[model samples]
Target: MAAMATWFLIVIYLAFISLGLPDSLLGAAWPVMRPDLGAPLEAAGMLAMIVAGGTIVSSLASGRLIDKLGTGPITLISCLMTAAALLGFSFAPSLLWFALLAIPLGLGAGAVDAALNHYVATHYEAHHMSWLHCFWGVGATGGPLLISYFIKEHDSWRAGYTAVAIIQVALVTILLATLPLWKKVAAQRSMLRASSRPHHSDASVKGSNKFTAKTDREEDIRPSAQPMRLPGVKMSMLAFLFYCGVETLVGLWGASFLVGARGIPAETAAWWISLYYGGITIGRLITGFITLKVSNRILILVGPLISALGAVLLLLPLPGAITLAGFVLIGFGFAPVYPGLIHETPVRFGRANSAKLIGYQMAVAYTGTTFLPPLFGLLASQAGIGLFPVVSLLLIVLMLLCSEYVNRAIKRKYLIA
Candidate 1:
């Protein structure tokens, strides 16, 4: 059983890598792809919006979907769906087909992301949650590298898409073969939950999460929590909104900000921005190890301070090396936040509620990705790119406030318990 569990986790890590594989391809290949399809450069934004829309919609619905289909089936189906989309993209004749393919691509990604995150949070150690996400970072970072290499080697964006598609298809085969492991593991998990159900004391039962208020104590009143119908739900959503928004904003505009405000060369800015992402990837690896010794609470609370420091550096008229370090610091600081929040979900709320809440978190995260950067873009157009650091700082502060408040509420049992 232990060996089966390990194998299942390894496969899940690969699935996460596949989940990220197609994501960066569209952005990286768009420059060369657009002309072939007779599309304007600006059309990339529209396609991106379409993809984000699909992802958001799917993430919102993933809880029910996974509840019905089971995690293994959902993951396999989503991966297959994503692979099919990439295959279509490889041969897409026009921007229209690309847009059409983007829908399934987005939907596939959302389901896989939500399912695996919730599953890992419920089934594995906190450190595994951090490590699995680190694997995702690997995939996200690898996608662009693959695209670049394929484009350079074959001089066709189609080649890159095809290569990624093949990789996904191969992964799907491995997933199919591992179906028995998922079944056995899932059965074991069910038994474990059953065994643990009777072990809770009165204090724990206060947080039992009936989904409807039945307890005499439920009348004690968390007036604000009633609307969301869950304790900590609102704050969790807000935290996701700000964190993902900030993440998107930084990645989208970091280079532009460096060029515009810091007087860095465009090429140099791009290089440094790549390192920012690399910092995230590397930092998550370190965070996984850190999780072995440190609690998620400390990591979650401390991470934003580091990010804020990075933002302050960006705001300062720092020298060249310091400016670069600021970006890296932000990336490293952000590394543990998203995954830490995820790993803590089952802890904060009951396991029965974690799936739906995580689905909501995923949806909100995508919404932030979908809307925040563009809105900030509009503001930057008027206020100047120098507002980058200011905006980033504000977003981080909001996220940190939400996180800290939720933690306090949980501690006080002031949340929906």
Candidate 2:
């Protein structure tokens, strides 16, 4: 049983890692698509926002669906839908069609995000959960590199996406094969629920055969206690929103900042983007290990401050090496925030509400991820690309404030020293 559980987790992690491929390709392919489609920079930015918007809507809806329907159906549906949407995107003829297709792509991605997150939160240990995100980081980094290779070969970005669509189809097949494992966990949960009910009378406890299947059914009909509400679930939700904003801002716009603001070549900008994700990948692994030894408050409070400093350095007229260092630092500093928040969510809220809480958190975060960066793009267009770092600096400062709030909440809840 223990080995089976471990194998189940491995499958879940693979499914999640696979999900990041599309997002990575989308980010890397933007520069090529913009020129091909005669899109303005803002239109390029809008492509990202449209996909994120779909994710936002679907994440919120998936939470309720997961609670009512369980993870198997949701995961299967999401994987199939995401595959179909990617196929649609691969064949899109115009910018308008591509943008429209992003909606279903986002929905499929969002559903997978919500369901997988819920599954891990409910079944996995905390340390393992952190490591699960590491797989996502791996996928995020690999996606861009693959796209870069195709772009170098003068291949169509459409072909790159077609390849991803095929991979998604295989992922769906693997996930379907693993459906029975999740059902076993669900059955265990149901048995646990049945065994925990109260006895009607003292006599019932003394092997009274009168307390039979009918009596058990009567007790099962009663509502269970509401899941334990985290003391600061609302505040944590807000922190997640800010974290998402920062993550998306860096991932989506950081390359543009390099190209438009710093005058780096498009190819160079894409490489730098990979470094940003690479930093995240390294940081998440390191932070996950660090988290096992350290408390959340220290990491939460200190990480953003380090990232804010990195953002400040990037804003300056530094040398290329120094600017690259800034991106690395920003990546490292921002790395632990997301996984840490996810690790804490299940600890704070009981497993029953984990999906809904994470859904709400992602929905709010996607709002910032989807909307704010385009506004930043417009700002850059108006004020100049040099303002990009300055804008990021301000967001980092806001993130610092949010981190402090989270720190205080952790202390109040006795989650930290």
Candidate 3:
């Protein structure tokens, strides 16, 4: 059983890496793909928005899907969807094909993200959660470099999509082989649930399944059900919203800020941006160890404070080295907040309700990813890229405030210490 559990962890980590493989591919390949397809450069944003919209819709529906279909099928089908979309990208002849394909790509990515996050949050230790996300960072970083290589070697952006699709297909095969593993785990959890509620009759379990299936929909997604009436749910959603906005704004615009505002060369700025993501990966590694000595709340508080300090550093009239240090610090500071919030969800809202809350949280987070950075882009266009630091600072402040409210709400309503 222990060995099986370890293998489960390994497969999950691999899945996470697969999840990230295509995340940044569009951005990296757009320079080449756009010219070949005869699309305007700005058209990339439309495609991105289309993908984000699909992700938002899928994530919002994931609670019901994951509850009914289970994680194994959800992960399997999501990866297959992503594989199909990537294959579509590889052969797309025009912008219309790319736009249409973005929908499934987004849906697959969002469902996989929400399902895996909820799974790890419920079943694993915080350290494993941290490490799992680090693996995602590994894939996110590798995708661009891999795509860039393909574009360089073959002078064809299609090769990048083809290579990633092959990798995703390989992952889907592994997932297929691991079906029994997921089944075993589900069986164990069901048994535990039955034993824990020995007094409940079959009717109760049936009712629970029905209730959970509709929780996200009736309470959150549907118009009649007041999800905000649920304790801690609204705060969690808003906190995730701000957190994602802070992270995305920095990632998407950091290089441009360095190049345009600080007068750093584009090549050097890109290198520093890589270091920023490296900081996030490394920080999560360190955080996995630090979880032994600290609580999730402390990590959440300390992280944003450190990130705020980094934002302040960027705001200062400093040398290039200091600015680079600021970027790294910001990344490091952001490392723990996401996983920490996720791991705390079950504790904050009973396990019975966590699935719905997590689904809503993911939807809100993706929505933040979709719209907030674009708003910042408009700001940068009007106010200059130097607005990066100020905008980051503002987002960080909002994140911290949201975290505080969430913490207080959980403590007051849920009594979660």
TM-scores for every predicted model: 0.79, 0.83, 0.80
lDDT of 2 by residue, 1-417 (tens): 557777777788778777677776765677776787787777756877888888888887886888787788788888888788888878888889988888887888788887887676555545565577777777777666766666666667777677778888998999888887787975664565467663222121122222223323432244225422445666776677667777777777777778777888666667777777778788878876777666555666677887887898897888998898898888788877787776555334433455556666777778877877778778767787677677777877776676566545544644331
Model 2: pairs clashing at backbone N, Cα or C within 3 Å: none
Candidate 3 has what TM-score? 0.80
Supply the TM-score for candidate 1.
0.79
Per residue, candidate 3 scores C-alpha lDDT tens digits across 1-417 of 556677788999889888877766765565457569998545655676778788898887888998899988999999999999999999998999999999999999888888887777556544688889887777766666666567656777788789989999999999999977886875665565556643312121123222333343433334324445666577778889889877866766776677668887544554566566667778888877777666677788999999999999999999889998998899899988888787666445545555666667777888888888767776666777778899899888888888788667644643432
> Which residue runs of candidate 2 sit more than 4 Å off their true CA positions?
185-235, 345-359, 409-417
The lDDT for every candidate, in the order shown, is 0.75, 0.71, 0.75
- Stretches off by above 4 angstroms in model 1 are 26-45, 90-95, 150-158, 189-232, 253-274, 313-324, 346-355, 377-390, 410-417
How many Å off is the CA of 40 in candidate 2?
1.2
Q: Which ranking of candidates, highest TM-score first? A: 2, 3, 1
Least well predicted 10-residue stretch by lDDT in candidate 1: 200-209
Error of 3 at 225 (Å): 10
Q: What lDDT is reached at residue 411 by model 1?
A: 57
- lDDT per residue, candidate 1, 165-197, as tens digits? 998999999989986777688677667666665
Q: Where's the lowest-lDDT run of ten residues in candidate 3?
A: 200-209
